[model samples]
Target: MQEISRVFDAERIQWASATASGHTVNSAEAYQATGVSDLLPRSPRQLVFVECDVLGLEPAEVCDHHNPGDPGYDRQPQEYLQGSSLGQVLSLLGKEPTHEQRIIAAADHCLTHAYRGECPGVDPAELADWRERSRAARFGLTHEEIQMRIRIATKALERAERIKVG
Candidate 1:
């Protein structure tokens, strides 16, 4: 979300997370949850539904990679299918992913073996550190702890050298 915002220079982009509740939430439900409508009067709104099915919305408005029949899923290169939502969003924005982004994509896709053997140029220690930070961020860290992890991860990524992967 931050990367996308930076790329587009968006003045404001409100965000809200909805519980899966054993199934993905519809776009309308996600929109209502944002409460952005109440904050702003009736106006044109661009709602981007990531990793969720769209309801009363066009396929182009979504960024899901789970439904095989969905355009979002069909559009991705086979190798990138594992990268999922992040890959889809980056592709949708026509952005060339950075080295850190590539690492994240690979990690998120569970390509541990590939990074360990196939991409030998990537340092295992750095990758492990990143994975630890990522897991901490996702699993129950307080807001402050998550922020600290992000800062540490960001610095580590900045210092990392880019390496080619087959």
Candidate 2:
């Protein structure tokens, strides 16, 4: 749990009972507080335009694990963004690669890292052993600082996910 907090606020999340989907989700104000919430989605509507097509599901599920809030969860947009985030990550690194590797390798790290500070020991190889260690570092930021980072990263992550590669 510390490792999760190192990158996010587990407390910031709660089961959104007012959901159309079965997976745990959030209202926008609620999500913006999480820091782990998707990104820059002023309304769920903007999510589709960014190609987060699966967002048609619901915001609540973003938090739910097996019991998912409404729809359990769909793999479409999630998989789609997995493919897309990989392409961009590789292109930026001047490489060509498979999608799964990219998601496992980078998308996750990008999701955890906050804007206000560096995530100490951010080694990709360390990720496997990281969970326990992360619990201690929880939020390298103060509360107000974390909120600011959330605002900045929301737009940034959204744009990153929305990127269209040529």
Q: Which candidate tops TM-score?
A: 1
Give one digit per residue, the lDDT tens place, for model 2 in 1-166: 1122222233342212222243323434322232233434454441111112232343321322122231212323233222233333333334544333433333333434412123232343444334323433474645455556657988888778565799
Q: Write down the RMSD of candidate 1 (Cα, Å).
A: 11.0
- The list of candidate 1 runs beyond 4 A from truth reads 1-47, 70-78, 81-83, 112-125, 138-166
Error of 2 at 113 (Å): 22
Cand. 1 TM to true fold: 0.48
TM-score of each: 0.48, 0.20
lDDT of each: 0.52, 0.34
Candidate 2 achieves a global lDDT of: 0.34
Per-residue lDDT value at 98 in model 2? 39
